[model samples]
Target: MSLVLGCNISTFDSTTAPADLFNAVRDQAIAAEEAGFDVVTIGDHLYATPGAPDEPTLEAYTTLAALASCTNSIQLSTMVTSNTFRNPAVLAKMVTSLDVISGSRAVLGIGAGWFEPEHDGYGLEFDAVSERMAKFEEALRIIVPMLRGERPTMDGRWYRVHEAINEPRVRDDLPVMVGGGGERRTFAYAARYADHLNITCLPAQLPDKLRALEERCAEAGRDPRTLEVSFATPMVINEDGEKARQQVEEILVQSGVDASMASEVFFVGTPAEVTEQLRAKVLAHGVHRLMVNLFAAGQDLDVIALTGRTLAPLVSGG
Candidate 1:
């Protein structure tokens, strides 16, 4: 199969009125659809991170539901939702609702809860990584079956869904993509449960990550190829390669990553060069899909449209 091209609007844009941001995002997604991008994703967060200068962030589901009405072709999804943010049963129902509205164009991209600040700020349970993984495992048990129109009965320690009915499911084959790189637990879960695995790692680390995922699939008695894999990295494409490299540094520094690690982390170059880099660094290692966060390009519609029109054909051979 051809590469699956997905875009994410990361939480890095300037502060703006909520309505204006929503409109801008809607227009961006519409433009992505028109430009032949397969999916449009949003970061799942309660509020903007790095609160020094306010960043305009919205609740993922609400924003996605709104975008579902505004766009026709591009699939709507969370880059990955925090498993602790909502009840899994309710989360499944939410995806079902979106699927009904978007004509079966919704995918559940979820992960173990990570941001401690959001959990503390919102007064939600921010358990340790072990406990969080426990919760994530239990949540998926409920979510997966419920989305397939099954009333799940789970009496787990972390989350309990007592035969909850998931109504209005449009697609029985609704895609469930698990995101993370924990070789032991997360990859095991993905091998067992997920239809897709969105690998969040630096480009250079992809080969090892894919190998680890394959090992986990073997342990789970599943063929690794059964699960689709996608790499999530920042896209920093510019006409001038040096400009792209500089912006990549800025983006990395803003995210608390060392500036020195910027070169191996983002797709920094012109469109053709970026595609060539991805093909060598990521795709050759066996990842066929790329989920790029549109941050270096200011999350603007024009840049996103350009990314789709320019880079997508290189992989799809269109």
Candidate 2:
């Protein structure tokens, strides 16, 4: 993967009327695509995360399907779908359907489920971490083969698929993205199976995480260069540099992070300043691909367009 920039629409404005939520999201996706983003993604959660419990959260696949209808070029995916939420075979079919609908622009971004509260609330079994990783590994065994147009039959400890079939796939080469920070299991899985790895960690932690991933790829007898790695972070940017910094500081304080460490957690400032910050803090560490959630942009079209036009160049080698 060449340097890619993705926009993760992780939150919706709480004040928007319930009936108009999808439209609001659609507009944002259009803006992102028009502004040169390579991919547009949303979180796969039954409830809102990284926000209040009562906030409206759309189902990931459904929202991506809706986005595919309106956006022409940008790829559609979940920031990371939880493997615990659906049967692996079914999840593979959903991705294949999205690929067909979007003219072959769907990416399967998945991870071992982590939110216990959602699982508990939905009465889904929240297994131990070891069990979850085991299930995730088994899921890949089933999902990958099906996505490649082969019927997969597997009777594993956590999942069973009997030659499950998938049809109407636009392409068998749809990318598979695994997102997580676990150095042992997650990194190993990404190296072994994933085409892309979105490492979820603070910016400063990336160098060490990249090294660990390299080690994992070596252990798996796979070349690390074959796997694309990316980092995702919250970004706050504006034409007004001081105002953006102030907003970032407030968020840092609310999250109980030191205000002084804002740059390590967020890309904040004017677009030019943010570009420089990203180069120093992210690209310099060998993480060329980046996904950002522009929480501050909200439904503001101008802000979204401005940020995209500014940051897209970083990935395009401008």
lDDT of 2 at 142: 94
Tell me the lDDT of candidate 2. 0.87
TM-score of 2: 0.95
Name the TM-score of candidate 1.
Answer: 0.95
Q: Return the top candidate by lDDT.
A: 2
Q: Residue 55 error for model 1, in Å?
A: 2.0
- Model 2 stretches with alpha carbons more than 4 Å out: 1-3, 250-261
lDDT (10s digit) by residue, model 2, range 1-318:
232888888888889999999999999999999988899898899877655567898999999988898999999999899999999999999999999999888999999999887898889988999999999999999999999999988878888988898998877788999999999999999999899999998888888999999999999999998898888868987999998888778766755679998776788889899889888888888777888888646468887898888887787762
Give residue 37's error in model 1 in angstroms: 1.1
Q: Candidate 1, residues 139-217: lDDT per residue as tens digits?
A: 9999999988789897889778788988877768899999998888999999989999988887777888888998999
Against the true structure, what is each candidate's TM-score? Answer: 0.95, 0.95
